[model samples]
Target: MEIFFTILILTLMVSLSGVAARIIPFQIPLPLVQIAMGALLAWPTFGLHVDFDPELFLVLFIPPLLFADGWKTPTSEFLNHGREIIGLALVLVLITVVGIGYLIYWLVPGIPLLAAFALAAVLSPTDAVALSGIVGEGRIPKKIMAILQGEALMNDASGLVSLKFAVAVAMGTMVFTVSGATIEFLKVAIGGLLAGIAICWIYGKSLRLLSRWSGDDPATQTVLLLLLPFASYLIAEHLGVSGILAAVAAGMTITRSGIIRQAPLAMRLRANSVWQMLEFVFNGMVFLLLGLQLPAILETSVTQVEVDPNVDLWMLFVSVVLIYAALMIVRFGWLWTMQLISRRLLTKRPMEFSAYTLRDLLIASFAGVRGAITLAGVLSIPLYLTNGDAFPARYELVFLATGVILFSLLVGVIVLPVLLRGMPRMDKTAQRHELQMARAVMAGSAIESLYKMEERLTADVEENIDADLLKEISSRVIGNLRRRVDGKEDLDRSLLAESLERRFRVTALRAERAEVYHLRATQKISNETMQKLLHDLDLLESLLVEKEE
Candidate 1:
């Protein structure tokens, strides 16, 4: 317990420190860098060793990360791309599993096809952390990123479900009949979906009721929202269903019906900040822990296993590497075929997202780096088979998983970016064209408003003076319109103008609250102090709102 706390403290300090920014030069992602740091610490000479309960890692990290991702995802966008997201999440996973399973079995020959299938299943899902890092801040097209994120989110459930089935087959705990497997799959999948919706609905309604009377304490609201994900997960898992799917479903439900749809502006902002912070810390820990576990995993293997000097570890290593390539190749093939189908039938004219050419296919292929879900499933593999005998190839399976992660990180992160660079760049002219299209939309609305005003004031106008005012208004409107349409007014600058205006007001309110906090933190602040401070905060908040207008 002491060791665990120490490691946690170190991880927290490293993540919160800005030192990582100086470590990487070429737009390397923070997660990847953190993992590298962990690997470095795990080296024999470095002598920093950390061990974690795999179960604890899941309990601590996975739920919040999944929930945060689910909550922030725009439901409307996800719904619009539901078909494509489902295709990638469900169908693509199966394709990688079968394809990689066959390849590994063929290459290794010693490992059973079923064991290979289990490995493949573990490697099928993509990492949300990896995807988010690679595609930063809507740098990619919103629709494309939405599909990627949505797929990554759902695939955690689908891949984990598939993994449990693979493990069952491995352990031979459950009899494998085609009909029985089908029924089991339905039970888990359908059960998860139903459980998620039910819990989310109830929880969301509960939140609405609570918020109505809770005085909207931002910290309190944030804490309740954080608990909802874990509670939903626990309930579903306890009921022998997919906790992951339940979490996903509940998140979607809450966002759709609770906060995004109904919460006040301040509440939404508060919730967003809370989720973002949780996401940051959770990701930092994941990569840090991932790195820290490397040495321990090696030490455990060396200590537990009796080594045969003649055993061909190289053969196993080579075979797993080949299998990793096969997984990626299969992913690419599936994505390409899907993209071809979508292009021909569904999407009419897709534009490039970011500097990448063939954005959809490349994003689909490169985005398949497996992480936490895969690691969890692999680590959860039972130690003994159904016959009360030792499980086959257990340690080798762990090595194989570690190999997959390393290979994916090395190849996917390093190679994919290079591949994407070759794609066409959307230059200044193209961006200007998009801006013009947006301005046209705003102008059309403004013109409609003017038409309504002209209709109402036609009879009330005393000819000359009224005509002059109308002309001046029209000219002013046209200038604003042309400034936007012709790209004469910088979009970023214009947005900054509004942002600065809002920021000033929010700063003043925050200052008043900060003074209250200072008083409380330094000593005992009385109820009088609290009440007066709140009154000032309330006035400042009103001023802030007025400034927003």
Candidate 2:
């Protein structure tokens, strides 16, 4: 009951913060506000304390977040930036782990080299949730956004895999050898990829069968989509592989494997809504929980330092600052190098190589704001080794991890907006024009198909169908196509007619819905009857207004 109440209050806090962000006029990021609220509530005066269970956190949060990112990512864009994404996600992660690991060991005394690497691994992945707010709001180039997103998705798997090896070495579960560890990493990564593909294939096939068998039940379809990430994660973890990667792979598979294409429109709509809500709630809770844990983390660090003089809290803080600086420096340098190399090697695609500029490099560097994943990794570190001794500098590790996250968030909040202010805004007019062109092409194809089917339709359904209504609808569609393809004068004339017809139909449907609601409100109609009428109105309105290209 206490736990339930805590969650309820936290959720309320998340909601309040979102509203405050919108209403306050000041451009404070929502997560930053939520984190502050959590910290204040967690103060001693409020007596609020939330202990994070690392394993539970990972299982509950990581899979769905990764899966949603994968599912929503533009596959073509991701592939176009594949080389850069790989460099950032895989190569950059490796560099950070090894480079920062050594730096931490040298700067912070009494921490094992491998344990330091573990800490580095925890801090490595740029959090997608944290980046999305800034990236979405900023006029960052589409290509850069794609690379950042793709890197965020893939790096989580790589970072976690690195953490796994580091922890094993730290816990004495496995002896670290460069060659052996590399082989093991490949095995785990490859195995997880294969497992994810197989799982998604089975899931996709089952989803298609269910859709066919049940005739597109949105509720069932939504539930199945909800379950997929968890199932994929669990299956991969059980196979001793990267569950994060598996979840990612499963999401990508579903998106690309015709599963979503085959689902009913209503089911897709419901599923998207469900996933969006889940992501919002989950991301909010994670950041808030990080804030809630701040007090306890600080206290643990202080106590540990007092008891053992070797555990220097100040040194850990300094190490965090240095490490964060190193992260930015390394990221900027690596990205510049990759761009330079791509320019000379790929003369055919000079535009792709030149797309990244100094400004972009700066934005991308600061965009490496660590969030939930780092928190999860640090918290999940085992308290004791196999010999039952406490993990070395555990509190320090947590403190450093938390410090990096907070610092990174601060950097992102302050720097991103300033950098983005000077960047060019996306051309809304141009985009609308392009969309119009595509819609015109689609309408042309649709008209061709309609003509092809006219004979069969007339022969089979002429008696049942309303031929006049069909002709009017077809005429309006043709007018819409003309409005896009024709001159401004012709467009205005045809558009006015089509617009008036659509307005009349939509207004009638809305009136019907209002009448149904009024009947229900006045207790003149049964709830079931009101619902049925409202549903019909909704379907009618959708048909009248909904446009897809």
Candidate 3:
């Protein structure tokens, strides 16, 4: 019962955070609001605490979230910006691990090199999810946003893998070598990618067989779809590969597999609705969890600093600020270099780094917000070594990580809007043109298909169907299809007529549903019958309302 109550409270808070974001007079991002609410819950008076188990958290939260991002990612754009993304996700992460690792060791007193690298490894990855939540959608230039998102997707794997090696070396479980690390990285990364693709292939086949056996059971299909990411992660982990990358690969592969498109409309609708709800809940839980940990994390760090004679709280804070600044500087420098290299390579002409606007460079630099993956990765560092000694400077590592994450988020909330404003937005005219073309093609194909369907229906005349009634319905459906492209006055009139018909249909559905309910109330119809009727009405009404919008 206590467990049930805790779940309910967390879910309620997640739901309310959405409402509170809109209700508040000032604009605060949803992630921040949820974090604030969490801190409030953790107040001394409330005394709410949830134990943080790093391993459990990773298995439970990371896979699904990464998978969802991979699923939603536009494959075309991801591929198009492939070079830039690889630079940031793979190369830049390596650079940060080395660069920031040394800086921390040099600047901080008595922190181990291995531990510093682990901290750097975790912080190297940025959170595009938090960025979108902070900046709001459609605000960032589309090109920049695409690259940033791609970076976020790929870097999580690289950063976590690097941390694994660093920790292993620190614990004397594995000896580190340059060549060995490279070979292992390639093996794990490639194996994980293959694992994800293989799993998704199996998923597609399973979906097909399930449909054949059960005949379009939407609930069963959705349940299977929900399991894909976790299956990919666990299987890859068992194989001693990068489970993070596996989850991502599964998501990306499943999207391209086209299984969802082949599924029944009801299944697709239900699956989309369910996934959206789960994504929101999971994301809220992450930020809220971060907030809940804030007070305790701070208290622990303060105590450690107090006991340790080497460092003071103020100096520790200085270290966080310096490290964060170094990250931004390194990030901006790399992005600048990448721009120059890309232009020189693509244009085949010598161009300066200043070819692009400083606004883009600055925006890209500040946009690297350390978020969920960072929190999870840093916390996942083993608390004790093989010899049972506490992991060196564990509290300090956590403190620095949390500090940097918050600093990045706070800086982004303040600075990003200032950089984005007055900058010309990315042109989406090509996208609009493509959408228009797609609609035209769809209308033509639909009309042609309808004609063939009509012929087939008429040819089967053994039953002596009503020919005129069929023709009237076919013409009306064809007229609706023709309104797909926004063009002439006739098209506009057809759309207006369709809109009016949709309203009438909706009204009729509501009336029918009310009648079904009344019959059930009066005992004129069985409860099951009333439910079936209402469900049918709701589905039809859903279509009508969708079209009206």
How does each model score on TM-score? 0.76, 0.91, 0.92
Which candidate comes out best when scored by lDDT?
3
Candidate 3 regions off by >4 Å?
348-356, 423-437, 459-463, 485-526, 540-549
lDDT for each candidate structure: 0.71, 0.83, 0.88
Looking at candidate 1, the ten consecutive residues that score lowest on lDDT are 348-357
How close to the true structure is residue 123 of candidate 3, measured as C-alpha lDDT? Answer: 96
lDDT for residue 447 in candidate 2, whole number 0-100:
66
**Candidate 2 collision pairs:** none
What is the RMSD, in Å, between candidate 1 and the native fold over all Cα? 7.5
lDDT of 3 by residue, 1-549 (tens): 876877788899999999999999999999899989888889898888888887778888889999999999988878877777888999999999999999999989869999999999999999988998899988898768888898898999999999999999999999999999999999999999999999999999999999999999999999999999999999999999989899999988887899888888889999988999999999999999998889999999999988999989998899999999999999999988888786767586433333558888899899999998898998899989999999999898999999998899899999999999887665555454454467667888989999998998899888577899889999999987777644333444545566677888888888888888889889999988988888788888877776554
lDDT of each residue in 137-203, candidate 2, tens digit only: 4367676777888889889888888999999988878898989988988887878777877888998
> What is residue 259's positional error in candidate 1, in angstroms?
3.7
Candidate 3 — what's its lDDT?
Answer: 0.88
Q: What is candidate 2's CA lDDT for residue 405? A: 93
Show the lowest summed lDDT stretch of 10 residues, model 2: 487-496
